[model samples]
Target: MVNVEVIATEELGDRSYLAHDGSVAVAVDPQRDIDRVEALLSALGLTLELVVETHIHNDYVTGGRQLATRTGARYVVNAEDPVAFDRVPVRAGDEIAVGAMTVRVVATPGHTFTHLSYVISDGDPAAAPAVFTGGSLLYGSVGRTDLVDPARTDELTRAQYHSVRHLAESLPGETAVYPTHGFGSFCSAAPTTGGPSGTIADERARNDAVLEPDEDAFVARLVAGLTAYPAYYAHMAPVNLRGPAPVDLSPLPVLDPAELAARIDAGEWVVDLRDRTAYAAQHLTGSVGIGLGPQFATWLGWVIPWDTPLTLIGESAEQVADAQRQLVRIGIDRPRGRATGTIDALADGRPTRSYPTATFDELRTARGEDPVIVDVRRDDEYAVAHIRGALHIPLPELADRLHELPDRRLWVHCQSAYRASIGASLLDRAGFDVVLVADEFPHAQELGLTD
Candidate 1:
């Protein structure tokens, strides 16, 4: 009997499926979390056969090729783009066989020109199929169409409309739907909240994007909610397309304050991989902090100069390993070392500092007190609507453009407290008295921010 297990990476908020038939297993959309997949397979006594991807993702660097390299499995994706490692290029109607199960490719080009969905069937006509609809479809929304060629927006939108229709009509009514992204993901039009896998019947009745039939109207609605792609995508896509180079995982020595100081003096960057709140409480001087939380790998690669060696300050040994792993996933190799005597070092005459945090009500009260509210969310999120007086400086750009922020009391916020805390901590270390709002901010009329 073939059993499908869904593995969710809490780090990237991405879901990948592992299908095992008690002998061989197939993995889809492997993110940076290969250890989970490896552990699952190890428990099942099954070997990996294939690693599949719907398309080249723009959000986080993919681990499909890397997993394949480590496991001797063949990497699979659309035939349009060339990929590294042993791969089997598939297109619409192509079938991939794994024991008694079969995965049929269905081209759904909107999120990306070469996006494809896989329809998994057990070979029995009586049993309904299960579709792996990567970024093409989600629980509450559809994938954003702006990431691809702007010239092909119309064409891609039309293609996406037909693709959705195809899934609705072509697949059996009871067919199960599985998507790669969910809520908190910036790839889709709206936040997606639900299980990693759902039924087409549920999505047909609940997903607003799927309810609309008029092609042009749907296209307009889809475009209206697109958030600006992270600055990392411009560089990540090419590296992923060319395939991430292999990384050496040797552990580095922990550097003392004097050693870290010298590295910083020579222009290297110190990355504090703790949570935003923890980092905000205290950090080393001149350190550019990027929390090792979800999106840690993506944001770290984006904000820091890739060529510079990174000195890490992790909360623990495990955190240090996690930080190192994340860096290698993006093909970043220069890990100078970990910070020795972490907190003790910061307290040793190195000008340690902390940032303040404010509750939602506190921020509202201070809005009229002449404080600058900086919204650190992406540009598109700010454009859709934001606090009237807030300035937009995405978290990825905050470290470099610290000068743009006025030298006064600053209040910062993001969709949640995580990003705001990180920004606040960075600014505080740079000698600014910053306050992080711990709640979601005003989004036009919906949020009650009149000023």
Candidate 2:
């Protein structure tokens, strides 16, 4: 088999692959940032001969078109995709020859109407091939069916069941399976088993799609398990289809304290990009603290109104630039302004606020005080396990439903404290007494906080 390198964008829970034969390479499902890919190609002394898109992705902007243009490689996409760009379109039963690799296309239309899987081998028919199953057959699960068209969820789920069975039966059991989603992406249907890498045999043994004999049952189970996804997902496909411009990661215009305060007063978003602990100690009164981390872009894009004039506050320009890269992946193309300095400097002696952060044990201590408990996890997470008396307002919905909260002090939490920290900030900004439960969920059970 040709040598394959997996490049993971852990923050987005997606992986892009580069396969080569010591001379030429093929890139699959690349993210918007092309520098990473170019760096890999230069390091390996391999020329990128082909860049492929498994489908018009609905999770993040694709860099295939731009990468192809810059490298002068042939950009290949499904012939059936209605993207607004020129490409070398191929269909099922077509095969392409690279240096020592042969790429065979297979139709796997469950993830989207035109999704394709690429099986690659190094000319030896006996050698097990590697299949790049973009969003079709994941580790032990499949790609979610609702993103393309929610109304067609049930129909697409049925298609997903059959497509998975087809792949398992057609390919060798030892064939290596590389999926692009399911690490933590909402685009992936949570499978029964997951690993860093898997094979067809492993999936055949444990995958729900292959194990479930009845198609209708598989469809129903898959559909029933679906949950809410990020609001930014709705824009990824359109941006991909319209053709994304080359990404720009340059520093943004600096905003002084006076301008930052003016933006907040004008009802614009001025988000703090510091860590949660530092934010809890001290933060600008009106700025919402969604700390800079893996989930920062996900929560920030979800809670803020789309296209709002946004300003970011960080302790350094590097922090703000990192946030900008994550934002561009989800189609939050630009930040209106930015500030990089200490909270004290950004505050410029203006009003500042701080809140208390506690664990489940501390929460129990404050129970007699009767503080409102709010669970900000998604419906699926809360449904599986949660404290009995806690209010269930998901983080995505919390900003919109603030008026529904009681005027009492509220304690906010999630599966982990990442989301809870963000929820606490929003509540604090709205003039509520907020205590962030900055710990894991298992502690709640240990402390007898769960029902």
Candidate 3:
């Protein structure tokens, strides 16, 4: 019997699997950090045999090559992929033997041009197989097809439609479906219905991509509904192709007050990782507040230039490291320095700024004769319902469209206080008088703000 241990990267909302049968094991779609995988292998007492990826990932750097080097395992990737590094090129119909398990490579494209799925059986051909559908077939929806090229979205969406059906028809109903994307990944075409995994039979019955009868309708809907991904996404494809360097988790150098000030003055990013409330109370001028949260990396990746030199200001060493780990997942490495205990920076003869964090009731009481209200939620969120005449600009597009916003005091809000806080900081740093609507958005409708 094959025992599968799933390592879910909660922050990224992606899962990596380690499947082993007594003596040998294989890792699928690991993150850039390999220590977790190493610990698993040591505990299980299984010799690593192979490391594999379903496709070239555009979400985060893969640790397959690094793990392979450490364990002396063979690295496998799609034969059709044009990666610069060498790997054991695999295609459909190729089977790899690992102790009591047999891994059958099955082509399942549409998430990317050269994606593959692995069907594993416990030696016996008739046993219910376990399928690893990387970015192809997810929990309730398929992966988005627009990530590769906008021009080929329709073509890829059509391919995705066929691919989901193929998995249902090809595998038995009892086959366990283990996918790499879903949970909270933006790569998903829609929000996943249940857990990280389910059976093929369950997916066939419930997944929209599988249940949709008309292929053209599915393609049209999928294409039209794709949301904005991170700006760092474009950089991942090339880095994965060229092979990402092994992750370094050593402590970063602390920046002196003078150097930090110079970098901030030179227009380099110095992100403060404390919560919005703390940042709002006191923070060095010119530093953007992207508090350490689930969407922290997403907004930072969205707003900052890819090549900008980044420095971090955190309340503690742990906070700085946590922020760095999240940033590295999206390929933002080599941050110049980390400034811990940044409260001291306020006394360095440099400017410090603060903004008001207000509730919806407060905004309601003072709405008519005040600063402009800007909603930084996504386009769909705004479309569903929003404050009637609030200016709409998704957080990802905020930096680009700053000039379009009025040069006046601005009240910024998102679905909740988290993103609104980030938006408020960005506006404040940009020299606009800003107020953060730090209350829950649903309350706005209940309070009649949306009306």
Candidate 4:
């Protein structure tokens, strides 16, 4: 039996895959931090035979080229892609033999012009096959079509409908479906509905592409539902097309408390890599708290000025290192410096900043004061339901549009407080008196706080 292992990057809502027959292996859509894949292969005692990319990813940087270079493996890319680096170009109808298995390349466009999916099978014709659907056929929905270009969105959406249908029709019922995106990634047209693994038969019965006999309706809903993705996405395709350089995971220089404060004073980004709750309690006045987690890089990249010098303030050296790994996936190679230890120690004599944490029930009581209530969730989320008089500022656009918010005590919130914490930090750094709403938005509905 062919063994398949999934490496999930839950922060990015994507997955990289490794499959082997207990001896040799092939990787699909490896992230920029090749160390993880390298470590996995080493532990398994498997020889790296091929590193393949279904398409140029618009989320994290691809490690296929770099991994192949390091492993003496052939890097496989779509034949039609206008990529700069040399590789074994593949096209539809091509099949590659790897030991006792066969990998068939199938053209599955719509996520991008030249996207492909790999169908891997053992020699037995009756055995079920495994297909790696990069961004084409997701678990329940399809990959969002608007990421390429606005003008091509309609064209691509139509192609996506056909591509998904094509896959369902061509593949057998029990073929295991391994998609690279749609776990929670914004690349999905809508939130996907499935656990870790699924099959083609599962999709055929429930997938919108196959269920909706009319293509136009699927395209309409998909186009209308496209929300804002991370700003860093604008840079990913260009960098991937040119072949991204191998990541620099070197440790950053340790900064003294004085230099950490100085960097904040110089208008540089001083980010606190502590948990949102702790950072909100007491943090260095100017440092923005984006808790180190799955969502760290996505929010930091969205709100911060690109290429700005950044200094990290963490509770320990390990927290800074964790942030480093998340940032490099989106191409923020190295931070300018780092400061570790207690927030007070790092602050030294500088005044600290703080904000109150509240729930929807508390917000209702505080509403009598007429404080500005800010909703930082996406537009679709706000459109569906929100506080009656809350100001709408999607988190991604909050940094650029702060002037639009009135100078008042602001109660910031999102679907969950995860984004509210980031919004609260940004508002706090801009010298606004902000309150972090540390409650799930659904509670607002329960409390009749939503419109």
Candidate 5:
């Protein structure tokens, strides 16, 4: 029997796997991590035959075209959309054969008009099937309807409900179901906190949206709970559709401190992905800071321009490589070069300083001091209300308007500590003394800020 090995994308936390039958392999929803996929393919010694994109993903730039180009594999997508790749346009009822395995495409378009789920079956008619449901069907929820035309929210909602029903009724009860996304992803409302793969029967029992028969009600519930899409999504969709120019990662001329300063003064952000303390002491002028911490990949993706070329300032060569890998995970492709002799390069010139941050209690104590409290959470979270006198900057917009912040003590907070930490760190690196509020506010009343 052929074996399928699923690999989660580094940044997406979504499932992208390789299905192989000894001699040939097919990749599903490949992320931008080409090296990792290549390594896996090399280890398996199987020729890559096909790349199947389940839908047009908006969250991160896809690597399907890149993978197909490198491996000479056919790129497959739903026949409805003219996806830019070596073409194998699959439609509902079409079956693609890879060696001894057969993949049947099922049009499942609630997530987007072109979403397709593939059912993989062994060539033997008696063998059961496994479905790669992409974003169309998830463990406990359906893909959000607002991703497409806002006016057709209802129609898309109906489509999703029927899609779930169709999968449930048509696929055998024992068919394995694997989804592309999981919890902590923006794609679905109720994401599975478990692994990348599950079964149709398990999802049918546990997934609330999948179990619901009333299409309109399901749509209403899903739409009501959607978090705001990241600003990157707006740019990534069209870029992916049209295909971006090949990224050039060749080393650029190493800039001296003066040249780096001039670039920073010209409004180019120098992101130092070293440790917080190193960034705190010395960095290029106007460089917003993020470290190679746990949330490094996420904050980098959130704050930096996807198209912008990054001049990485790392403490060591290893850190620079780590930073590069992190950036690539989220599809940030234009890495200009790493600053060698990082400390020595800045020793002859003035090093930029970082900002200071305050704690929740410090915010409370200094409430009367009139410090500007910037809540970096999204507007929807702020609509539920925020600390009194807190300005809503949203982490994604913080880099653009750092000058708007008054030259006073700045305090920042988000739902949990994650975003606030990132914002505070950036502000700190950009020369603002900011404090992160570590307390979790269960209700609006807990926030002691004034209106």
Candidate 6:
């Protein structure tokens, strides 16, 4: 029996797995940095026989080519993918042998036109299979069919329904299900509402895509549930099809306060990777505060233009390097320089700005001032229920919709205070008088602030 270890990318909430038999190992859907995968191989003392990609990923660049080149492992991707790179093309029903284990390719096209899932078996004909569903069937929902094209949404949604059922019927109830996009990834039809990996029995019993009575209802529900994803997603397919350039992780030059100020003045992105609250308290004016958290890279990729140069602003070298690693995973690797502890320098003489963090009750009292309440939550969350007349500008769209915002005090809020602080910081930098409604959104309803 082989053992499976999941390598999770916290920034994107993505999962890549390594499956190893006694002598050989296979890495599935690895992120761009091959160091983690190589470390695993060296630690296990097993030779990497293959590196497989389940699909043309539209979220992060894959490290299959690099891993293969570095480790002399054969690279495998679906034959249908129009990738310009060289690799062994896999088709549905094609099986690759790795020592005592067998990886059977299963074509599951819903997330993208060329998506594939790998079923790993112990080579015993009757042994139950373990499936890597890779955005096909997720924890409770399935992959969003709209990532490719809006016109193909209906067709892809139907295909997703059948593909999910195909896995359920072909695999045994005890078969383990591993998904690459889990833990709040935007690639899913809905956020994965349950724990990481579930068994076939558990999914068949609980997953809405599997349990829905008809495909039409499933498609309608799933399609309607999808909200805006990062705009960087559009570039992912072509980049993956061709190939991503190797990430450069060499130490970036540390910019002095004056040099950093010049970059900020020149309208370059000087991202402040601090906690949201800390950022709200005080930050260098014009620095965009994208807190160094799980979703930092996702939002940064979404808001920052693809070719724009970036300069990171953080408190420590560790924080800046960690941000760099997160940025490279999503292919935003052109950080020109970084500045650390600008806040400490500003504390003595230079100017710094802070925004007021208001609770729900406090917002109610201030409502008479007629602040422009900008709800930076996802559109689906806004539709579910939100404060009446709160302007809906998802965090991803906030950068482009600045002209549409009213010229009054902008009070920003999301489901939680995290996004609100980000929105508030953006608004503040854009010269708007900003106030952050820092309480939970549900607390608004509890306090009679929302309809």
RMSD values for the candidates in order, in angstroms, are: 3.2, 1.4, 1.4, 1.3, 3.2, 1.8
Q: Which residue runs of candidate 1 sit more than 4 Å off their true CA positions?
A: 84-86, 193-195, 247-250, 329-334, 346-348, 359-369, 379-392, 399-403, 436-450
Tens-place lDDT digits, model 2, residues 224-321: 98889899888888989889988888889999999999998998889999989999999998889999998888889888888898999998999999
* Residue-level error in angstroms, candidate 6, position 393: 2.3
lDDT of each: 0.75, 0.90, 0.87, 0.90, 0.73, 0.85
**Which 10 consecutive residues of model 3 have the lowest summed lDDT?**
341-350
**Clashes, model 4:** 0
lDDT of 3 by residue, 257-374 (tens): 8988899899998899989899888888888998898888877887888889999888788988888788777888768898886566533876788988888888888777765899
RMSD (Cα, Å) of model 1: 3.2
Query: Candidate 4: where are CA atoms >4 Å away?
Result: none
Residue 190 CA displacement from its true place in model 5, Å: 3.4
How many residue pairs of model 5 clash at the backbone?
9
Name the weakest run of 10 consecutive residues (lDDT summed) in model 4: 188-197
**Tens-digit lDDT string for candidate 1 (34-86):** 77788989988988987889888877677788789899987887899766544
Superior candidate under lDDT, 1 versus 2: 2
How many clashes show up per model?
A: 1, 0, 0, 0, 9, 0
Across residues 1-451, which tens digit of lDDT does each residue of candidate 4 receive? Answer: 5679899899899999998888888899999999999999999998889888999999878988999999998899998989999999999999998877788999999999899999998878888989999999999889988888879999999999999999999999999999999888978888787767799999998789889998888888889889888888888998999999988888899999899888889999999988879999999988888999888998898888889999888878888988999999998988999888887888788899899999899998987888799999988888899899989999988988989988889999998798999999999999999999999999999999888
Off by over 4 Å in 5: 193-196, 244-253, 293-298, 305-309, 329-331, 340-347, 368-370, 383-385, 399-407, 425-433, 436-451
TM-score, one value per model: 0.87, 0.97, 0.97, 0.97, 0.88, 0.95
**Compared with the true structure, what per-residue lDDT tens digits does model 5 show for residues 1-451?**
4477877654555778788887898888877766678899999898999899888887767778788888999989766775564468878999888888888899887888888998888776666678888888887677777776879877887888888778988887778877887645677755564454577787778776666767677777777777876556666667677655554444444667776666667766677776545554555656766777656776777687666656766666677776666565456765665565665465456654554444566677787778788899888888886787788899999879898999977777887766776687678756677766655645334555534
